[model samples]
Target: MPDLSIQLLPGLKLKNPVIAASGTAGYGDEPNRLCDIADLGAFVCKGTTLKPRAGNPQPRIMETPYGLLNAIGLQNPGVEAVIEKYAPLWAGWTTPIFVNIAAESVDEYAKLAHRLDKVPGIAALEVNISCPNVAAGCLEFGSTPESAAAVTRAVKNATSLPVIVKLTPNTSDIVALAQAVESAGADAVSLINTLRGMAIDIKKRKPVLGNITGGLSGSAVKPVALAMVYRVAGAVKVPVIGCGGITTGEDAIEFLMAGATAVEVGTAALVNPRAPIEIVKSIENYMLEWKLTEMSQLIGAARR
Candidate 1:
């Protein structure tokens, strides 16, 4: 078999280059029932916060042609509850669990990092800076290089674990944003978070989602995501984890060729629980047909 293992960071090595995106696997309990968590390179838990969030109102998810729109609003139990409940369970699994955290303030981000630092079973942190910073009048921390760097610095100061800043495609300059986070101590970076989108209910004469607007994801966003990953990869020295609309091994390979060190399977897993594993298999098959010996040959093959 082709070697599928990869080192995402100095200390964070994954058996494969496929991660189960945050929220899709819901802390790994339910998904484990549908697919083996051990098969994934890593699992990012639901987007977490300092406090438990009820999330946005119902009718929050809508399916579009080859895409998914969600305004779930970071619904998650408080960090303490997650540590107490899921940490124990994660400690026993062979797969590393990365806690994906979001916060409204810089302090909250640091605190979340501090709380999870040195905790057993938790291998790393994936900071979700796409959230609104209430202190900045609802401006998303990821909207600017300054705010994004602030969050990255805060989290780095508070934790010893590797920090993977999950970048938002909503930014004006994604390459700059990636560079900012990388300088602020991000060990790796992942992108692009869902694009802003909405739908109108033609029959009801109203919006489809209660939140009115939500993040757009799935195969529809693949092209846009591929472009951003390619740009950011060239801009930063840190590993880039490509996400958005990746539904198959072919999709994963596109990101890899575009310079992604790994790929995150999000909406596809919601469509098929076995998507991640299936993608891994397909990548392996491709490597075999091409006679590739290691992941390095594929990590940025197209860049050449």
Candidate 2:
């Protein structure tokens, strides 16, 4: 090991900064079979709602040029089931487990937060304020500062666990939303959730995804994600978790340089379940090559 640990918050210290992004990694069970999730810093489970959702219709995903477009619609087994089934299993693991939560209304978000707070295995809460595929409350809360803040405040008030607000890239002013969540009492922030995008089947003259539009993620969105993370990380005092199109350790380094205290791996896990593990190794190698030890030594070094 290369002293990869980092303190994302005063009390929320991580073994390393490369965590598994939600949706792609299913509550640490699926990937744990292929790769020991305990090797990574932490992993956020798929988006959980107050009630179960069937998600959108079939063909909810489409392959794009450099990434994948998905509209999972926050499909989950509901918060109650999540705790009943996985909390005990997670409690034995050394790696922290943060549950990614999505809800249609502010009240639901708060209620879900309160419920998750009682779960013994959960490490923290990452509010998914940026699910653009939804037509109702999630999209509404994430698209604007007021609604975003409303959601953030509700969850913060409901839970004692550290709350990390995940910001949507679909907004005109991401910085404003970042600040809003901070003011509303978020402990940290994660930026650049997949960009809102669509793909069309030219020959069929129709959209590829059943939802018509989906979130764009993968190596292609790195520049845009990096720019947003850089802007938000510098602007907010809260630690920023950089997510979006990160497929390699080199990409992870770029995000940390851009000012992200940590980074999350999403789409890459789809291609290779071992990507996160490989990324962890790659990061350790980078540390050795640069004669660095602590992962904190790389964070925001580019900005300074």
Candidate 3:
């Protein structure tokens, strides 16, 4: 049998390399119901904030050709509520639970980290640097190396658990952004968050999404994600968790070969609840066919 397990970061080990992306997994409850959570590498819950956000109004999601456009606006319970309600359940699960956190300021980000630190159920923190820093005139923290590093430092100082900075593709230079967080003490990095995109209702003469603009994900973003993962992986020494449009074991293999230690499934799961588990099975099958003994032989194979 091939070994799918991976040490994603110091003290953050995954049984495999297929994590359920945030927003799609919904705190692992629904996905757990659909498939065994134990079969997944890790699970990232919806973006949590310091306070509960109502999120955007109606028509927050729309189906585009070959992709999904979502402006869910990070609707999630506050960190305190999450700990009180879900932490106990996560403590009992075998799979690692990563809380994807988003905030508008450095102080708020640190506070969320501090609040989640030492929690029994949470294994790590995936910082969503795509949130705009209110203090910086609403400039997204992931848009620049300096601001991204600042948030990373604050969060790192607040929590002892591994911090994986989630990079945004909307930035001017993604490689620089990844390097900045790595230098700021990030344990690992994940990319690329959905590309910024939107659609129009020609009949209604208006935008399809309620927010007018939303994040683009699914098959259409795979190539961009693959390129970003390959570039960021070469630029940093930490593990890279590839995400975007991974829908199959073959797609996951493409990312693993590009140097991502693991991959996160988002839109695919939305389309099919069992996508993550199937992806795991697919990887196992691929390993069997390739006669590979372990993940190291397959990971970064393309870079060579």
Ranking by lDDT: 1, 2, 3
Give a tens-digit lDDT track for model 2, residues 8-52: 865878988989998997877653577788788998999999888
Per-residue alpha-carbon lDDT of candidate 3 for residues 195-302, written as tens digits (9 for 90 to 100):
888899999999887788888899999999999999999999999999989998999999999999999999999889889999999999999998997999989999
Per-residue CA lDDT of model 1 for 1-304, tens digit only, reads 8899999977878999999998887998763576799999999999888889888887889999869999888889999999999999999999999999988889999999999999999999999976421232113788899988999999999999999999888877999999999999999999988888899999999999888888889999999999999999888999999999999999999999999999999999999999999999999999999999899999989999
Worst 10 residues of 3 by lDDT: 130-139
TM-score of each: 0.97, 0.97, 0.96
lDDT of 3 at 76: 88
CA displacement after TM-score superposition, residue 295 of candidate 1 (Å)? 0.4
